[model samples]
Target: MMRILLLAVLLLTVACGTVTPPIDIAPDAWISYDHKTSYFVSDAGADSVRLTVKYASFTFLDKSAELLPVAKSVFQRISNELAEKRGTVRAVYDSSKFYESVAYNGVSGVSTALVSNELTFSAKADSSGTPTSAIEPVEIVQKLEALKKALDSGLITKEEYERKKKEILERY
Candidate 1:
């Protein structure tokens, strides 16, 4: 009886004393698509983020419900931006079996491209040991501009340029 009581108290103490570290949200550079769609990226507390995106189609023509060519262009531009980021999506699988969702599982990291699609943005760490992104918005724009110029100059073929550009934009 005494052992059982002691075990209960110990379990209670352990459960009650558990602590969750604080998170930080900061801006990161090298994480760009276009000014119009950049707002979709947001830091989830400090450790993670929620990346929601909508892509565009340049080849698609205007339809009855479709707003206009201008809208289609905008959608295509946004889609291009989103695709740029998607290239870095590494293959990751959950390790935990049953209770994996309840525990903090470490990330598996991102994949590497053969020619490299987008630039790397370093993660920011705060005093409390929280990691966040430190990429700037303007830097992303400049990179996009450079990419666009390279494509326009024929340095990169239309297909290759469009593909790579799309990958950069997809990074949510």
Candidate 2:
């Protein structure tokens, strides 16, 4: 009977381990994001920004060896509005998003979230004095449009949209 019980426990562990993380667990870029990915931003003061990234509980990393280029895209967009912004991006893990999140991948049924870590990137201002932006940057207007789309699709609550809208506008 003891042997049977041990076998049962082993099976359970294997089943639980079957749950895969949404992002590639690469040594180089363990965390990644894409155009579909969205995150909340707030001013943490000291020229530091706080980003609430969503992540799957099944696959979470307290620290990744390197920051993915895709994640850096978020910083580039933010720097467009706050040209003077400086400091490293710090990631903090929290269950808040897991509690508050109603989002999931329809195809895989995996939750989306940021690994939540701080990374450092320096933004260099253009000397041309022209409005042209580096291709890495996304315009505020575009972000607003995306937020509206999420609302229209019922992906987020009206209150969430309003709060994010305010946060984005406040920085610029």
Candidate 3:
């Protein structure tokens, strides 16, 4: 009877064990998309600005109504902050997501193209806004050199090397 009880407890424990999903870390230049919203953060001068855009289905009228105000409020707050910093934030609001690009003088701004079927808007920046492309020239040169070496060593094809080289140059 004790053996049966022990076996039952072991089975219960095994069955109850929960497996958690791994957390995702956002990349250096891109922000992680949340279930209801996607946001990007950029630094301008000494200040950092976050641009958040919420998503909701248009078919769900109640849900859309609920989320629209929240998205507007968040956008307003970010716009106010940027204006205070003498910065500009541009965002495109589609039915599902908000794609944003923010630019400010004297600071690194996030600049990304936002395309939507409904609307497009932009605010100009005084300074060049290409933080992600601000990779060290030396590093890019090194990577190019490495690619060439790979081609020479027959580790990669000439076509692959050229494609990678073009991609590297486009970043600048």
Candidate 4:
């Protein structure tokens, strides 16, 4: 009886203490391979994050409405953190899992991706909104073109690429 009680307490403690770490990243570059994304974050930030929600056969699903919340959460965290540090979050890269409502065992959701312009504004732009130290409109066009290529190659879904492309253009 005593052993059972001790084990129960230990299990409860572990479950309660399982805090998911915040996604801390300010990447110079990255590749969002559908779900398993690899970042080029500096030494100060992790260079990768992975989700096991999908695997071999389940990989490369389309982004559904259910997954939008996960994506939004990721963007919000990074944007807020960067803002607090007096910097701009030019982009946020992440893949999220959305669980289904009817879980017989433990399950649920969809997929989406965002390829961001990792360029931040220079401290000195000299009146022009363009970042003096960053790429201009031409670069944005290049990024859009590259995104299209990714879509063509099936690296990213149509919705994911289109959404990312729109975000970049709107911000420019």
Candidate 5:
């Protein structure tokens, strides 16, 4: 009976270990909006811009272990907009997208290369300009909602949620 219990515990450990946590943008990430574009820069650094959406409803994926389609679309749109605005964009390091490239590609050869490449290039292009302090109130609300979702999903602790909430509120 002891051996059987040990085997069950080992199996549980292995099962839990295999489950990957969902990906979320940082609470302290910077958001900058200019005209029609809204840039959600990664808190990690200027190297990565988490999401850039233009005139669209941004939805949060529940319990998603991989980068969701909506998120990809936002990134892709940002890339296109950057190319249109600046004529060209240079590449930069992006850890989250890099992980997605490796993990997502391995799961299903449907490459997320475009999302990574576009964001990297755009980050470099946008880094040159000064971000405006003025951001749309709607955008701020959306970001807060995203953070709240992260908290609800157990991706962030209550303390983290409050801290991030305060930081975001201070922006406006």
Candidate 6:
């Protein structure tokens, strides 16, 4: 009986040792963000003056093992968006979209939540100008419409369409 128990213990140990390790085991890592704010505005200052708006700071965490795939998928989507426009583009994370997350502790085998956060981004700009506040939302809608049209027309590929569509829909 003792020998059988020892054999069982050894088998269990071998099974445990053969399990795949989690990709990210560290507590801290470098992060990057696509946007600073989800919302942007342009205010009119003078006649025909363009107001350039900027968003706030965003943080990216490199420690999320599960979220890594989600993050990369989002990034690839954004890159596709930029590739379509042939113009400068930026993406930001929707803080409102952030959901609670949980992770299994490697050492304890217990589930733990490593706080989740939001990130946002804006296209790089050099000049600062004011935009008519009244038309800002209208302009955004028109832009979205244009993007949709581009997708339908095949000017932007399907993958690009899906990504940009998701990005825009997240705004609403």
Q: Which candidate is the best by lDDT?
A: 5
Error of 3 at 158 (Å): 0.7
Candidate 1 local Cα displacement, residue 136, angstroms = 2.4
The estimated TM-scores of all candidates read 0.25, 0.26, 0.25, 0.29, 0.26, 0.20
C-alpha lDDT of all candidate models, in order: 0.37, 0.44, 0.45, 0.41, 0.46, 0.39
Q: How many residue pairs clash in each candidate?
A: 24, 11, 1, 3, 0, 15
Cα lDDT of model 6 by residue, 1-172, tens digit: 9999999887665433211212332223313334421111222232111111112221232223454345445434543353234233333343344333333333333322222223222343333422112223334677789998998888999899779867766654
Ranking by lDDT: 5, 3, 2, 4, 6, 1
- What are the clashing pairs of model 4? 63-111, 99-108, 100-108
lDDT of each residue in 1-172, candidate 1, tens digit only: 9999999887665443211212222445234445422223444333233332222222222221232233334433443444344432121112121110011111221111101112222334455544343333444566689988999898998888788777666652
RMSD of each: 20.2, 14.9, 16.5, 14.3, 17.9, 15.8
Supply candidate 3's per-residue lDDT for 152.
96
lDDT for residue 96 in candidate 6, whole number 0-100: 43
lDDT of 2 by residue, 1-172 (tens): 9999999887655433322333333344332344444444555555344443443432233112123333344544543434444322222222222212223333343433343332223334455543232322234677889999999999999999999989777655
At residue 158, candidate 5 shows an lDDT of 98
Segments in model 4 whose C-alpha atoms lie over 4 Å from true places: 20-74, 77-126, 133-172
Steric clash pairs (candidate 5): none
The prediction achieving the highest TM-score against the true structure is 4
lDDT of 5 by residue, 1-172 (tens): 9999999887665433221212443535525444323444343344434333322221222123343454455556555565446444432333344333211222222312112322433322235554334444555788899999999999999999999999989887
Query: Per-residue lDDT of 25-76 in model 4, one digit per residue for the tens?
Result: 3343343334533322232234222221211111233233344344345544
Better of 1 and 4 by TM-score: 4
- Ten contiguous residues minimizing lDDT sum, candidate 2: 92-101
TM-score of 3: 0.25
Clashing pairs in 3: 45-107
